[model samples]
Target: MGTMEAPILTVNNLNKQFGSGCDQCSNPADRRLDKNYCPACGTVYSCQNITFDLHPGEVLGIVGESGSGKSTLMRCLYFDQEVTSGEAYLGPYKEGRSNLFRESSQQKRYIRNHLMGKVYQNPVLGLRMNFSSIGNIAEKMIAAGNRNVAAMEARGSELLERVHIPVYRMKEAPKNFSGGMQQRVQIAKALSNHPPILLLDEVTTGLDLSVQANVLDLIKHLQRELSISILLVSHDLGVIRMLANRTMVMLDGRVVEQGLTDQILEDPHHAYTQQLVHSLL
Candidate 1:
């Protein structure tokens, strides 16, 4: 086997805040310090001092409870939401690196267009729910400048095939598919651009155990075949143990422990990590 290369994405001190936006009022309806959205004050700080690196061919799992800022961090990294402060470094070389927090529109667009791909917790949110599966995937390809219908269609077909979605269902709207199929379709769409790094934000949430296992296996197969680095966020320990190379445990807006998956699972250092592990059992 060849030696594995290093990470393509690194995050340092990442932070995001809502309600503080000039657009929101002083007496905001929602506010919380650790919660992505504040309940009392309407101020949301996704978290502070959050950091991690995603290596090629590696699956990094981020685990925390519901209010632990996992989704907010995902949004910031994937560009769905703004970064309040700090840096998200992409790629290895300084020349190729970018700070998601401060990059210009053109720069951000370029990075998003070329390197980023994301799968949301809810597949419908990530997908063009109104379009056929093929149209949804192809729309992303076309927007990224693929205009040859024959090639686009062929590629789209291959994508669906790779995700185990039958070509006959290509014209059906995602609404017709089960939650699992929708997740698979969303994966196909994310891979349409051949992104180097794929971020999955709670992709298996709310699914039945069997379906969740299938989706997890599918993602592992894709990662192996495509050599794409993955950053997976979840509250499930079983999922992390099965799929991740490294795991990061978070609590009250801080990373309490991070290490190889097996190590963290078997022997966690922090009290919060211990509690999380015990709870999982």
Candidate 2:
């Protein structure tokens, strides 16, 4: 919260589905097949309704058990999946203005290029295990229109050092690093350009408690230093409590409860929240 900035991303009433039976494709191989609705259930709300905002310099945590659509929501935001309805006004959706319910391919592309960064739950999914951390980060910078090899490598080394990974290891293959270290490399890659919005999906899921704590501290430090907004998706209530300013509890693809982190943690209103909190205690 060091600087004044507008909301970087907004999503309203977003809906997504796998197969609800609204459209049919004669040839499944066609990538340009038109989709009006669900193809299996013929329903509009095939998945669920989701509404959220990612403001500058804030951390919003989305928490739920497996299959509750947490990952689906992240995928939709990142354009890995499509939204059936609702508005997603990202970097360029509304002529660079704010539009909560509008999905603009142009805006999505702009955000992907200049405003958004994402880290997957498994670092291997985002990081190339076969390449060194320097190579992994350098590839992203090059893809983002940074052509100076020396400059890119310098920046990559800086990023790795910022994330607490020694710059010397930047030349080692990512597979040689431990899970926590690999996750740090993935973070360095995500931070290559310092995007305004960072989407993290279960970043500490497979790590030990000690490693998780270290990673969490690193993220908090970066968030404070960079003044970037974060959207965290996780199934662990403890992690959410530790990191999030606000918490959104999802169930069956829908948000069940959302409020201040302490409010929801101390006095959960939803049964789902209660269940999650009790399990953690």
Candidate 3:
């Protein structure tokens, strides 16, 4: 990303806590740092003072091990969960100045409908197993206010093809499809509105290596085709390296390090990140 291109999304002082704070749990130092557990009251702090900026058309990867806050952060940004504090501003909203965290429910719906798309780790989370694969795609289009059946189905069919699902299989239920195929359907549906930003959470986590490669290749192609920004969260550093321009290393509910994907992999600054890099060797 060019230095001159303003960030499309900026997250500042983000925090997600599971329990109400108590006097014993309140620590000023903890407020400024990442602490997943309160020493005094045992509250779970899922995310702590996390901040980052995603430039337009860039793929920002969040990498971490299981139990790290990568998925939690993604969930917060996409509004699948609530944030305890801080602000996330989407530059494209309100002429590049709306704080998404401060948006009303109706306005948040508008932002979700118009600006972003999300693909979850589980295909079931993103796709309706009982619905026809094509219908799953149209569901998003309909939610976005497209009422014309012909146009919606046509658009769905077009996206199915784009994701490498055979157009003939569009009428089949995703429940009957292979996991890889189901994921493809999820991707097609996510792209229904051509969102500027896509949030992907472990889209290829369970697939076989070859299948993962195919899915990854498709994503790479779509990034080029659509020029969309992506916030990709995965435990796999290989996936992050392949997809992200910038990578943030997360550990125990916070970004411990962040830099160019290549640089981060080649020369990790944090001990946790170093351990991660070595483990991949």
Candidate 4:
């Protein structure tokens, strides 16, 4: 994606916390804590001043170890978890004028259903285990106000096929599928609405190496075919290297580094980032 084009999505100063702040942690500039936690107040800062932009038809990867707030950031953007404070703008929503975080619940639901789709790390969170795979895809379409059963069925089968899930198995429930298949079904469901922006939160985290490669290849092909903008979250630098054009590195609830994927890999500036790259070597 070119830098001249406006970003498809923009996030500013996003923050999420698990507990109320005490006197010691009230002011961000003066707060003292263990990593992201405030010892005296027991408040955990899951995401702190997180900011980034996702360009059209671009894959922006967020990489960090566990507890680095990468997943929490995805949750906030997808509206699965509320942000403590932040502003997000979607280029296609209100001509990029509204702050998505401040929208009403009804509007937020509208955006979630129509403007974006998310594939969670866990299939259970994204799909109904007991429902047929196609039914799960239809559920998302229904949320977006689709009423024609025939159209949904056709679309569901098309998507599942695109993800390499056999058309014959579309009637099966996700619980009966293998871990990789479950994730593929989740991807199909997320793409049901043909959303412009996709939030992928560690979609290949628990799969075998071969399965992970298969899923990643599917994502790469689909992204190019559909020209969909993706925000991909993972702890694996290798995954980021394969799929991301730009990369953001998070640490201790904050963004420690970000740049072109190649530049960061070759000349990492942060100490933590250096360690991560060294491990890859």
* Residue 135, model 3, lDDT: 94
Predicted model with the maximum lDDT: 4
Task: Write the number of the candidate with greater TM-score, choosing between 1 and 2.
Answer: 1
TM-scores of the candidates are: 0.89, 0.86, 0.96, 0.99
Error of 3 at 57 (Å): 1.1
Residue 198 local lDDT, model 1: 89
Query: What do the candidate models score in CA lDDT, each in turn?
Result: 0.81, 0.80, 0.88, 0.95
Instruction: At residue 8, give the lDDT of candidate 3.
Output: 87
Q: Write down the worst ten-residue block by lDDT for model 1.
A: 25-34
Worst 10 residues of 3 by lDDT: 26-35
Lowest lDDT 10-mer window, candidate 4? 24-33
Off by over 4 Å in 1: 1-5, 19-42, 92-94
Residue-pair clashes per prediction, in order, are 7, 12, 1, 0
TM-score of candidate 2 versus the correct structure, residues matched by position: 0.86
Give one digit per residue, the lDDT tens place, for model 2 in 78-140: 877778777766643445466533546765565665567789998867889999889999887
Q: How accurate is candidate 2 locally (lDDT)?
A: 0.80
Off by over 4 Å in 3: 30-35
Residue 79, model 3, lDDT = 87
How do the candidates rank by TM-score, highest first? 4, 3, 1, 2
